[model samples]
Target: MPLVTSRRFFELGDTVWARWYSARKETWELGTIKEKVGSKMYKIFIIKYEATCIRHIDQLLKFTGNDNSLKINNTDNVESRNFQSLPLLPSMPVNAPLSEPSVSNLRSSTIVEQPVNTDAIDHGNGEEWGDYSAQDSVGDSTKIPEASDSPEASENGVEQP
Candidate 1:
């Protein structure tokens, strides 16, 4: 019976061969593990490329040297080390309620709104002006004057009130 040993994870700072793809060809590059970014994932610094990249455990192969000190002895009971899974992004409240800022809260203390010069504002075309609450009625100048007020109305024998 042959014994099979599996190296499930690599430690930070361990030298490993990282898989690289170039022009449809798969190549292996030497890299040093720099960080454990996620479950079964690591950040490695590729020596040849002088660049750091994230890779999964399946993409990395541990480098064992002739020095006996660097070799990890395989054991039948060997288990993979448990690593804490770091969050890639800050956790946000899943069901946080969104709201519009109140008018008072939105107003800035530095912004002082100047009083509008309502009296100096021209309503245009010498027309009668009224307060903001003004509305159109039968006699209101702002309303289109009824045809009864026209000089042509007198010619038509329509009595002017």
Candidate 2:
């Protein structure tokens, strides 16, 4: 009767696939059957199935003969033990003093107040005043001589009246 139960289990697996297939509206095919030992007391059969002929798998397994003697092997204890034995390194102190001089202190001694020029300093070149006088003559038109109204008038007295 184990084969009948296994067949019923396979049918249950088909029901699960049918539910999913109908929900998604797609075709699925069955693949290899493998048994997995879950915990210490229960043996599970994982059936490989395909969806849309893509070679997929599904698992459908429960306790055999209604016996609840199955125990799940706990692997979390090993991780917890390793974590407990791990050495926590101390963090380095961040308040160490700097060995180099700061920008403010380095620039403080080098900054000297430049003396302001209160007395007029002579440049010793007379061309400076010549340029200034030229600029003044150009700016004031009264300094320029006006052209005489009589075009024939001569300064040396050699022209006609």
Candidate 3:
């Protein structure tokens, strides 16, 4: 008889693992399964078992309780039974919500770099720049009014006016 292939679902705790493999191979591992839903489809599944080695082959036969000849006859049915047994397995509750990545405490762990000398530098032209400084005022604001409005004695080579 021609070999038949079918879809099978297995439950590993709370998660579901699906695969399609021939039992005749004497061992089967969880291999990836791809389904075409529409024009564009994408999904990833992990294979949890491999039977290329003699040890693995023995292990697989032990798990399925079937030899190569028997496997060829009931490969599809065996897979179906394996799928149904998944839900019966006890699944632990997920402590953290899937939407939350469980790393909220790490969000504020970044280091901030601050400029050490934030104050403006003085160019030393006797004029102070930037907001709020004593040197910013001009036109004799620093000198007291002389006794007379007329020009006083010229000092320091400054022209009196």
Instruction: Give the candidate number with the greatest TM-score.
Output: 1
lDDT of 3 by residue, 1-161 (tens): 98985333322221223222332222223222233332322232323332221121112111232222222222343332242222222443211111212343334457899886545666676465555465455444677656454345344444556
The models' CA-based lDDT, in order, is 0.60, 0.29, 0.32
After superposition, candidate 2 runs with Cα above 4 Å error: 1-7, 10-23, 36-161
Worst 10 residues of 1 by lDDT: 78-87
Pairs in clash, predicted candidate 1? none
**lDDT of model 2 at residue 70?**
21
lDDT of 1 by residue, 9-57 (tens): 9888888767765444455665689999998899998765678999988
The predicted structure with the larger TM-score, 2 or 3, is: 3
Summing lDDT over every window of 10 consecutive residues in candidate 3, give the lowest-scoring window: 53-62
RMSD to true structure for each model, in Å: 20.8, 31.4, 21.9
RMSD of 2: 31.4
What C-alpha lDDT, on a 0 to 100 scale, does residue 154 get in candidate 1? 83
- In terms of lDDT, which candidate is strongest? 1
What ranking emerges by lDDT with the best candidate at the front?
1, 3, 2
